[model samples]
Target chain A: MNMPVSQEKKKIFVTVGTTQFDELVTRVLHPDMLEIMEAQGYTHLIIQIGRGPEPQIPTSQRIQITVYHLKESISSDIKDASLVISHAGAGSCLEVLHAHKPLIVVVNQKLMGNHQLELAEKLHSERHVVMCYPETLKTTMTVFNTSSLENLPINNQMALSNYIEKLMGF
Target chain B: MGSGGHTGEMVRLLSTLDFRHFSPRLYLVARTDDMSAKRVQQLESSHISTAGLFQTVSISRSREVHQSWITTIVSFLQSTLECLRILFYYQPDLILCNGPGTCVPPCIIALLLRVLWIKRSTVIFIESICRVNTLSLTGKLMVCFLADRSIVQWPELHAKYPQTVFLGRLV
Candidate 1:
């Protein structure tokens, strides 16, 4: 079943967390990729660029794309988004998951350690998110479709709360 | 809280606390760490009915990635003083933190308070799930002496640090 027109018009939020993922940002902003997103019915794209230098975004009268430098709060943006394309930062992943949005995690291999890839692999194995390498982002987005987003398991808050209660000896 | 991944893990762990029992919780974050503070506020508003139940204070960050030792030392001293002041005023019964350089000062100060018989706040240090094979620098420091209870997400780490409890992944 197709989503209602209003729901389909919801923006896609692309965030790199506090660090820059220039490669991912570049792929996302590519005219061809943006066209695919536009075809998918995303009317607007909101990107949190973090420390990455601003990419030359192609002008599209059809889809409105806004770039933010580094936001202290992107919760509202996350909430408003139908899909989230984020870096493999656990913070960004968790926030996207908690919001119950469809997520695509792009790992930055240039990081000091390959830890981000480890996390991406784990989450991908769990079917919690789709994982893509930074270099392969364009190909991933080219084939991107909404049906790829499986329904996430319930938020981990209740289980975490229960555990904390037990730990606190309550 | 530090920033990025550590803050995310900390937020998930904090979400599980029975806030009714742990009333008036205080969150200590780095002075420039807007991300952590925003996250804590969001979590509280979503879960808890009480408006003022969660309070946040910004303290100095102990170090930055790839920063020099001299910069780290200066930041650590400043953060340590801030931690002492916050602990003295708030006087929380239990202090819970995850792996982050920012967490070190508070954990150390809490230990000092307990040793000096000033205040006996239990410090619980949870190693981040990202540390699959080994503990982070902050985790190594706290797991040995400062933290009353040190928890690890991965069993391999638990084997390495037998004393630290292994609970499954919180995130």
Candidate 2:
């Protein structure tokens, strides 16, 4: 009934914009492991559409595919989506957390030059989001991205918000 | 001195430069005060005059909506406007841009006032930043259609944007 949700399909938005996602979806220890994600009871996946290289999930009658691009749409789409799997951008991480959705952060190492590894590691320590490193993505992605967001901590987000507000005087 | 081809690269180089030679005043802008001040302090203490502009949107875990598109827009606009104001006040001879969205607006202002108008101010780009193409969609848009003198780290990037001058390796 709300805007942005087209239908009631079990959609999982796994953004493969940054190189981090490219590496994860492309380099499976089992090259055919995309079947696992398809069979994981997902009705569809919305990936970030880009020129040339992008994530490839088997598209068929049963499994539908959609891609969301444009930096402007990020805040809106991230809010509308049921679940978010995205890069470990400070803004993205903060937005996903603000939405109170459990986030699976895939860091783009090649682009970030290992900076995201540091961001993800620091945030993971704070229990903010799940980190999916390229080396351990296959093994850890399943368990790490269970999408159980019931355990929401209202305190930290509010506290951080308050701190930022006080500092900004807005 | 800086990394990448645009403002971030400039931030890195101008940061390392002997601003003490001129005691240049500076202003740093960001989306929120969430970013720690250590980096800002270091740049300032190195003889560059400095100040910051940031305001954050409230995000609580229990709130009905998680992401505020409105807040994000406001934050961007405010940071951009503040960056413009910083330009009017500091009037630095050069502006160093890092890849952050906060820097884009001011860089654009600098471009209009300096580059387009042919003001003598320098706008140097950092060569060792995260390449925008492979970054989040927003990251790419943040640097759209800007940057005057780009000090690109990779020879490949120089070919990607022929306008970017291929400076030597970033330190």
Candidate 3:
């Protein structure tokens, strides 16, 4: 008899667009770990998907990357991803969660010089997106092999009701 | 301050300034056609005067429009006429313009009708985004341009326009 492989099958997709916030989080993920990620048969990896800003660092060949600006353009890609990493801007988070994809969100503090940190923290507390702050990023990525979108918080029914309330009042 | 950086920050700064020493009537103009101004009003309801023109038109012949010369001509005429009506009525002591292209005509009127009753009526042009880059472009022509003081959110603007003063980020 054989044991199941230690790593779960993985498909990862990343996005940081619509706001200039991605630069901070994008700085951290090194291009080297695709071996550890790929060896375990983590099937796919998608990174840095946004059109506005170009990457400051070089990219890794182990994973695929797409810089998508419009929400409609990202549908099939998110469906193919197991985990979605992104900046904590409201619009991007809505798109990730709309697909019921697992998420790790990083907010951009340097660009607009405003309250994106607060917005990120609020999302993490609400269980909508996992916080990818400076310290937690490493642990979060290592565990990426095991994580599944099924366990992460994605409440379309609840989100739709909340979105409707926000719309009706406006 | 209606919902953006320059306008939002300016409202807070004005609250702290010694306005008690000088009488100033600050009117927050809204473009009924624009959403940013509406969000701004919601953010700072207590701080600004809500009355101003409700119509707005863009500074484009058309974006992604294959053909619209007829529509563009009609909008240009309508915007010009409405602006004339606003300038004659508001006569604000100080015009603080944080924009949408809607502010253009009223501001042009403010400069054109310089009254001797006041040594100078203060008009401040505030820029946060590059939506209408016209304000920066105009500094080349007028010695003391559209607004008596031009306030920009980006510090880089100060270097570009010697007349501009940089205000810190709008929340």
Per-model C-alpha lDDT, please?
0.80, 0.49, 0.49
Better of 1 and 3 by TM-score: 1
Instruction: Write out the backbone clash pairs for model 1.
Output: A161-B16
Cα lDDT tens digits, model 2, A11-75, are 55665542235564454313344455555665665666433254455444455666544342366
Candidate 1: which stretches are off by over 4 Å? Answer: A1-11, A35-44, A51-53, A60-64, A70-82, A143-152, A155-169, B34-57, B88-91, B154-162
- Fnat computed for model 1: 0.44
Q: Which stretches of candidate 3 lie over 4 Å from their true place?
A: A1-9, A19-29, A32-36, A48-72, A144-170, B1-56, B59-171
Counted clashes in each candidate structure: 1, 20, 6
Per-prediction TM-score, please? 0.78, 0.43, 0.40
Candidate 3, residue A6: lDDT: 57
Q: For candidate 3, what is the lDDT?
A: 0.49
Worst 10 residues of 1 chain A by lDDT: A152-161
Best by lDDT: 1
lDDT of 2 by residue, B99-153 (tens): 5445566666776667556454555544343342233232333335555455444
* Top candidate by TM-score: 1
Question: Candidate 1 vs candidate 2: which has greater TM-score?
Answer: 1
